[model samples]
Target: MSWRRALKDTARSGIAVEKKRLEPLIAVRGAAGLAIVIALSLWLFGPAAAASSAFGAFQAAIATFQRSWRPRPELAIASGTSLAVSTFLGYLTISKEPLFLALLVVWTFAAGMSWAAGPTIGLIASSNVAIMLVTVTLPTSVAQAAGHAAMMIVGGLVQAALIVLFPVRRWGAHRDALADALAAEADYARRLRHDPVASFDPQPLMEARNAAAVTPRQARRRPAELHGARGIAERIRPVLASLADPAMGVPAEGPARDRVRELLASAAALLDAAAHAIRHGEPVKVPPAALATFRTPDTGSILAGAPYRAMTRLNTLLQDVVETAGGAPQDGAPSGARGTARSAETDDRSTSGRAPTHPGARGTARPAPTTRSRPTFLALIPKALKAMRSELRRGSPVTRHATRVSAVAATGYILGTWLPLGHGYWAPLTSVMVMRPDFSQTYSRAVARLAGTVIGVAVATGAVQAASPGTLLSGALAVASAALMYLLMRTGQFATQACIAAYVVFLLGMGGEEWTQTVPERVLLTLMGGFLAMLAYAVYPAWETPRLRTRLADWLAAQGTYAAAVFGSYADPSASNAPDVRQALLTARTARAAWHAAVARATAEPVRHRGLSRTAADDAEDALAQLGRVAMLLEAHLPERGATPVPPAARFADALRESTHQGAKAIRERRVPTWDAVREALDAWETENPENADKVVRNTATLVLDTLTELSEALDTAVPPMTLDGTAPEKPDGPRNPKDSATR
Candidate 1:
């Protein structure tokens, strides 16, 4: 490769990195409106007035940032409180450097660690760095400090007003969430086309659904998008799994196969169409006659019996999606967006496994349990503080991250004080913002921050030169620059950092700070901060990937407990404890969430030290997902309607309990577990009766055990698959499934 060619390749790669979207017309108008407002304000108000108002305007601009799709009162309050408190702290400590710098370290640490509390609190804590710079070092008097604080509060209020008035970005994130989920389902459908009968992993699409659910959903879009996609997929997965079972003896590559293939392809197309419509904000456009394929016996039709039952349900789900696009809940449907979704995954989780969670494979679930009442507004403070205290006590990764951030930021603060720069606070601010709990995120931010600062400094200098007619012109230019910054902020972290740098430059320039002086100082301080943050991470980092194996072990242990608790419910439906079952599910969900988060962080970790290969990691993650699926099924499935409630047989119940016990022991002890009663029961059930519904339940139970066994063996923790009641143990070093022996 020639040097010139290499350079060209590098340039091309850089350009391709940013996937620019065609901005919606409304979005463009919103940006223009913001620019005009800022420019006009500066032109009308003198520089002092404009600069003072900016403390409000800048914050207002940021209020409409990532995932802030709705009017969240708690968020508004949190933001206001953070800004006020941070500014007050700065004002109090400006003349007391030793005290302030020490507090800065502690404050930053808390901010960094607050990520454990979820996105909302984390955003609030992140405001501390901004206050440290804009409030603490700059505020000259008590009156000025109070005045600036009031103005900033007003700015946040203004942003909230704008949101209500314009409503341009309403449900934008919600729309994307639905579109992404549908698109992921479509992709999964495509994969299924090649292997119509085989049991492929459903983790990727499952994950997309999980992520979509985690977002703040609009109440209106919830019912259609929530349970509809994941619920339908979960329902369909087992139908395919059961159909693929060799015990059923359904021939491959027949008329049924061809019909199933067309249905799957059509399902994929339908999902694609829905995804397109949601993303473009158009009504779902699918033929109502599309249902006729399942409704009538046609060419290449497999519409009969259980498959037909599933097919009809699929049609109903499609109708639900279309209705969602049209707006509001249809007749006989659950109200609210996530209400039905809350039950979606939990229902039919055990359909693939008859672990007593769903022996008859019935997928209907009771309504979601009512949530605890919301605390009064004042109670939020105590609740948040209590959460903080609890988070600190746990010697978990969140605690460690908080400690790292505090130490690094404090060091940066001290450095700023020692160094001679026009605006030394930028160093500590950079340190605080650049260092993140996520290792990959931290590194990326550091790089972006540096590049953005350099670019911003240059841009600010040029703008100042071009627009410096007087104070009014200077202030107007600054406001215009701020609007430009807002336009680019969410485009990418790199773009955001660049815009922030320019915004700050232009903002200070309105206060009569010369571009030549402020630009160099700003760039230098930013570079120092970025460098310091990177160095700190290199010295004392918490790598999630290295700890993934341990987290997986914890997940497996939790799964064992969850499975045991759920199976106990199956043993005697009359004795089933709803609260206990719910608790077990919540535990499993927590464990599952933790393991997935760890896997994500590990994948994003530096390649040389990422620990696990992507393939191995994905397999582990998928196995965990399968376990969660079974757990969900157990929670959602209920006893058959009007049937005499007979207890699950001792043989079945004992095997389940023992299997779960051994699985847990293996994960904790790092020894492979051997099956005994489980194998015996499966063998007896499969061979004894071939044409009973009870036999199907036993087969499902066996399938679930087989999957768990495979998962355990994959981790090299399984001893063998042998009868625990005196049969010679067959030890296998690698993973294997129980033989599909179906002799009738």
Candidate 2:
């Protein structure tokens, strides 16, 4: 049903759903490329060295998937270096068990703890696996070990070739994120049209924002382009939220409502166009009539004041989006407004500073892409050393996780070596592969690893029985199987390559003298490895249950800060508060991202000896999500009080201040606090300033009140104490889900 809906939506949207359609084909093409590389290498090296070269192909395939999301040039560098380094380390350590073991502990510890530094560091650590494998081949001949390690590099080169020669659309992730944000806007618009009284969830839009910011690879290669789109996306969030405010009366009904919805739909279409434009480097075009209503709003409709304000902001932002996306003025925005918006965008770009190491992917472009000098290798050494020191500091997640991973790997290796299967490498391999920083990912991957093993074993055994494909065919098939795994890796279907990996493993082993005894031993070893990884995590968690509540508090404080900023902005927009607003939003985004990470851990966490149950944790997550929308609404519809006389700004500023404090206090105290002060402030403001209480101001006050009430309910919902034994202490733990009581 979802697929059918997706198809219908794609057809309705008029743009080709190319990414969704091309994933499988990309997988096949990438696999084919890797296979060709391996096949050619095997031919050159001969069957005597097939196993060695096949290992290279395996590494290359894994590296290809790891680096695939990045731009072509960066992918080449990272993937190439990773393969070479791991292979070099792998070969150098062979026949030296003590050295191999030492390297294993150090590398695994480094990899597990590397998350402290950042994404790129973390990626390098997690993906480098040759060192561990090299340890397993202890007591092997130097020539044989070197040959296999060298093959890995050759395999990586093949994968790189495929990316360079037949690259799929670059910036698919960025495009998808932009599309998602636009979709979110459209959904919000539709929801406002139907029911403005109900609370909304900002999670979808937040997820989109998070995805774009998750990596900065695109930023490095094309900061000017990608950041411009990101800037537009971020800037538009407030405007959309404002549109949702009932006070804005964007489209209560009639032609005005239709025009508003039409504009929103067109905005979504514009996003689609921008996405395609980024990929193809073409000018983004929109229907000339698309945002006509937004460009020139109704004169005497319900959109007189607030909607007019919305329409004006929309004009500014839409023009800015088109300009940054290298799009044209096809949306029929006034020429004067387009120029103004472009200048505004440039001003933002000029003032926005770049991030350390990687720049922010905020979707807002600066006046220009500054020519900041890239840090040289020597320059980065100090920072890298500093980061290492920080990670090794007592009780850091990185340090704790690293120590845990090292211990587990050592234990797994010892157990494997003691088992007499001579394939003990499988245990440590599984242990290293499965153990990650977060319990959720660790457990999930453990399940995937085990499931994939079972499936791969079954499929490989059947293939072996079905066809004796001879030496050449088996070797080629092995490379192809490795390629397939890399190809399907990014699809998030972890099991997609299980069968292929299994096929490669079985096929590679078949060439050896002990071929008959290989499959069963491998199956057993794989299971052992999976069990060990899962158990290690259970014994020593990288993050505790209490951290979940701590993260939630962080999010609560973040929203409180944002709300306070929004309130202050509403009270006095002319004041130099732009930096405060921007910083507040950024802080909130960071906090939200952290909370999201914590929630993910909670989900993947072992259910026993934890903080809140899944249901309670989920409720807390939902509450925060709802609160985010309200906070955003404040930012969006915050009435400018400098030049224009927004009487409501003065009326609700104190109320908002009180509410923000109360809400944060409630979240921390684990109790629902009364918002009597907010109501009192509102009452006093309205009573003292009756003449200022125009319909618009009154509606605005009502909106703020609704938000506070929702905030109160959110804290109340999660405030109830939860038992550790999975039983409810008092009432049924919160709601079954946050949405059950969504309508505050």
Instruction: Give per-model CA RMSD.
Output: 6.9, 8.2
Question: Can you give the lDDT of residue 618 in candidate 2?
Answer: 66
Global lDDT scores for all candidate models: 0.57, 0.57
- In TM-score terms, which candidate is top? 1
lDDT of 1: 0.57
| TM-score (all chains, Cα) for each model | 0.78, 0.77
Tens digits of per-residue lDDT for model 2, 1-744: 133443343233221111322365556755675566556655776554555555544544454444323344344445445555665676576457778778778878877766675655565556565233632342256665566555656656666777677767666665566556655655555565556534544455555444444233344664344544555556665665566455456556666666555556666566566656655567777656655655553434545566656655666666667766776655455444333333333322221211111122223322333322334434554776678787787767778778887888888888888998877777777777767776656655666666667677677667767885677667665655655565556544345437554654545553543345666676687778778876776687675555665666667667656655665665564565556766776677778878777765554344442434455556656655655565665556554333344444554655555556655554454544456665666677667667764455455455555555654555455546433443445544765333347555
Worst ten in a row by lDDT for model 1: 348-357
Q: What TM-score does model 1 achieve against the real structure? A: 0.78
lDDT of 1 by residue, 339-416 (tens): 333444543232322222232233334444222223543655677677777787555667777887787777767777
Score candidate 2 by TM-score against the native.
0.77
Error of 1 at 255 (Å): 1.3
